[model samples]
Target: MTITKKQITFSQAINDAIQTAMAIDKSVICYGLGVTDPNGIFGSTIGLEEKFGSQRVFDIPASENAVTGVAIGAALDGVRPVVVHQRSDFSLLTLDQMINNAAKWRYMFNGIHSVPITNRLIVGRGWGQGPTHSQNLQALFSHIPGLKVIMPSTTYDVKGLLLSSVFDDDPVIFLEHRWLYNQVGLVPEGDYRIPIGKAKIINKGEDITVVGMSYMTIEALNLIAVLSENKISCELIDLRSIKPIDSKCIIDSVKKTGNLLVLDTACKFGSVASEIITLVVEECFSYLKQSPRRITLPDFPVPTSPALTSNFYPQDLKIMEVISEMLSKKINHQKQERPPISMHDIPGDWFKGPF
Candidate 1:
């Protein structure tokens, strides 16, 4: 049980994961725009070129579609490629290759070949990134078959999950919250892989079950502290992997607690939150003490104005309010003492960014 644990930032953990993968496997290559630069896409790709040389770690042109096609070709040829995109918004250009080619090649060929491609997509809100710069389209990406989609909220997860995604046999859309970049947590040194389709319970309670994805997981953890004071004990489930969500973990928790609240980054009609809630109602409905619920961004474009953006994303107070309604308890409407929110539509002050 005794193992070393050292605190590291989320970005550094990703860097460590890529480095570890490259060190063990010569087939692993890291390439993307500005991947070899000094900032290194928030430092995840810094020093990669120096260690692995230009051929394996150099930058690519602004041609997203062509770059993705090339990576797919390489992966089919047995090279593991990790492609980094500075923003998820622009990765839309590569969706045709991702959805049609990378995601469907193995099945089309009757399982003779697989694309072990890892696309590192930086997602979430920060620094007024606005509609064009910030978006978490996990639901859209996860909808396609033969693709693995994961959103890691912690540094430990950032490292282990990146390693897992790199070694995975199918295309993996690794959606990372840029806001979680500076969050520090203990990570086991060296190579380790968290199983791709599992969920982790960050806080255990019996009154209600709250499943939070990506940054919402962090917000759920924060909200739990306040909910506890009002005698509301909640079970917090962080769905690290989105596509093959750990229904077992969520169902088990909801069965015990009999209450469910799903929180996610986007507001798709049939979103991650909707699917999880539907799963609980279908399977764990008999155990329900309260109706299942969810909180998500409005089904609209993200606002660029910081003033308008403050209310665009979900918040802890929103969770608290939702919980209050579920419990049939009144929330305090009076102006109360609370710290100011520095980052709107984002949780945790973990981002130290130039983006």
Candidate 2:
């Protein structure tokens, strides 16, 4: 089936999703820090207030917990609040409402009440963001029950998942990687909803099953060419929705390939990577030709220095080494072209600021 498409950046797709949702449902209100500011939360929330008016699209105070409580209250009263936190670290302050109230309102009331809210949390590493600002805490949110945790990688998935999260009755944690804002791709025009808890198989192959989450998906995609050159057919799966992982898709792929390599944006310990590995081990241990492996940051805080961070995060060279060991095949790393950027911190030359 052919999809109606237009070339747009990841951030534009997010803006389009919010605009489309608010236009369709008057009850859907977007308000958070920098919503009304000039940057418009890295341009995703731009022009929303002007088009939707102050009552529907406005700004909130710096109090994360208080703003979250207000959003939850509004959601309980039939409002679908889209709250945006500039950084995922800021969201730590609102866990009381997120974990206890927003996530549990529907179940706590025995389906009598539904808190349909979407919290957009931006997470990434770059430009000396340091330990606190650059945290991938999706696992923390995913551990909680009654919440939908989504980490979309593509422009198409981001918009579709955001729309789905906005409409769903349960509270949703929408995590966006800052580096992906400028990445462009063909996205459907409007009103498309990719179902929650479904993983997308990006590339089909036989040698190994490689799963990546958030920005790590992009990283994995970059290695496909080199892997292909070495006759390593990789089946790439993007774990878009973290909370309710698509176990069937992963298990089937692993059963076919008899190998699994997971790449996670979060730390190594007790991460989404670990969770997927455990699922495969429990469901399809007999199908494995070798032990499953994962590539993730060390179980420690992210360093601020570029020199430290360059090696701190999982490098493509390291990934190739692991794949070589996993499949007992060699990958020609010299043939792999490095990313076109002056520094490792910035995603690309198009990147402009600290937002």
Candidate 3:
């Protein structure tokens, strides 16, 4: 097992994934708004058009529905099209094409056709982008049966998952959190494909498990470090794919720790966290020592003000506070489960306060 290192931003990792996939498969094509040439927004697709040439990597007009329709048609005709929407909110404009067309094509055609297309969406709540641009709509596409929804939190996962998405037979909605573009992580030097439905446990611990996706995974890791300094250990699970969720990983962790906490940038209701909690309760209720808790953005549209936006979204501090409370409760419950022992059985100064 050899390790190779390269310093690349999150956005560059995505660009690498697209480039590698296209190099591997000639059928793979990239297109969408700002994905081409001079001054591409945020530069995620920078240099792609030049390297792949206009025929393979071209730009589309400001019509998401039309672009999506074209991608789906291409997929049906045996071409793998990777379409990008400027923002996650823009995906709403193509709901008809996605929900009715891309999602139902194989089923409607009785397996005679497959939509091997990837729709890349940039999502986040920042820079006063406000209500229109800050929405995290991965949950919406995850609801559709035939669509695969992937939200990678790290550069490695982004690279591997994006490669896998381009080759998958079903249509995929890849939601890239805009705010994570600059965050750095180590990625393998060569091409690799991470299994679509598997989850990765970034940290291991016995006390509790924190499950998150995209930027929320970064927040979970940050909270884990903070809690460790306080002598509390936590496991972090990154659910890279939302649609085909890794329930086995989630349930196994909950069983081992007997406690669960989900951190999601999306709203609390009808979100990925809600579905995960429901799955854990249904599958591992006997193993759970306490009820699962979730830290999520408030169930409302994001605000424009920076101060208000910070308050609206979930943060590391909020995650740390919730974990502390859960740990305290767990300690109390353990005390009740065990029998009391004599003073001689206890450690010295056990009853002393901060001594």
Candidate with more favorable, higher TM-score: 2 or 3: 2
Estimate, for each residue in 293-331, the C-alpha lDDT of model 2 and write its tens digit. 999989889888888888887866777889999988877
TM-score of each: 0.94, 0.97, 0.90
The clash tally of candidate 2 reads 0
Maximum-TM-score candidate: 2
lDDT of 3: 0.83
* Residue-pair clashes per candidate: 0, 0, 0
For candidate 2, the 10 contiguous residues with the lowest summed lDDT are 331-340
How far residue 50's Cα lies from its native spot in candidate 1, in Å, is: 0.6
Decreasing TM-score order of the candidates: 2, 1, 3
User: Per-model C-alpha lDDT, please?
Assistant: 0.87, 0.92, 0.83
lDDT of 1 by residue, 1-355 (tens): 6777899999999999999999999999999888988899998988988998888898989999889999999998999999999999888999999998998999999999999999999985856677888888898998898988999989999999999999999999999998788888999988889999999999999988999989888877777666767778889999999988899999999889988989998885879898888889899789999788899989887777678877778777888899888878765534333356566544434443436
Per-residue accuracy of model 3 over 1-355 as CA lDDT, tens digit each: 8868688877888888888888888899999988885755466788888888899898888899988999999888889999988788989999999999999999998999998999999885565778888789877889889999999999878988999999999999999987677677888776889999999999998889889998889877765555666677788999999989999999999999999999887888898899999999999999988899998888888787756655677666677678878878322111222234332211122222110
Q: Best to worst by lDDT, what's the order?
A: 2, 1, 3
lDDT agreement of model 2 with the native: 0.92
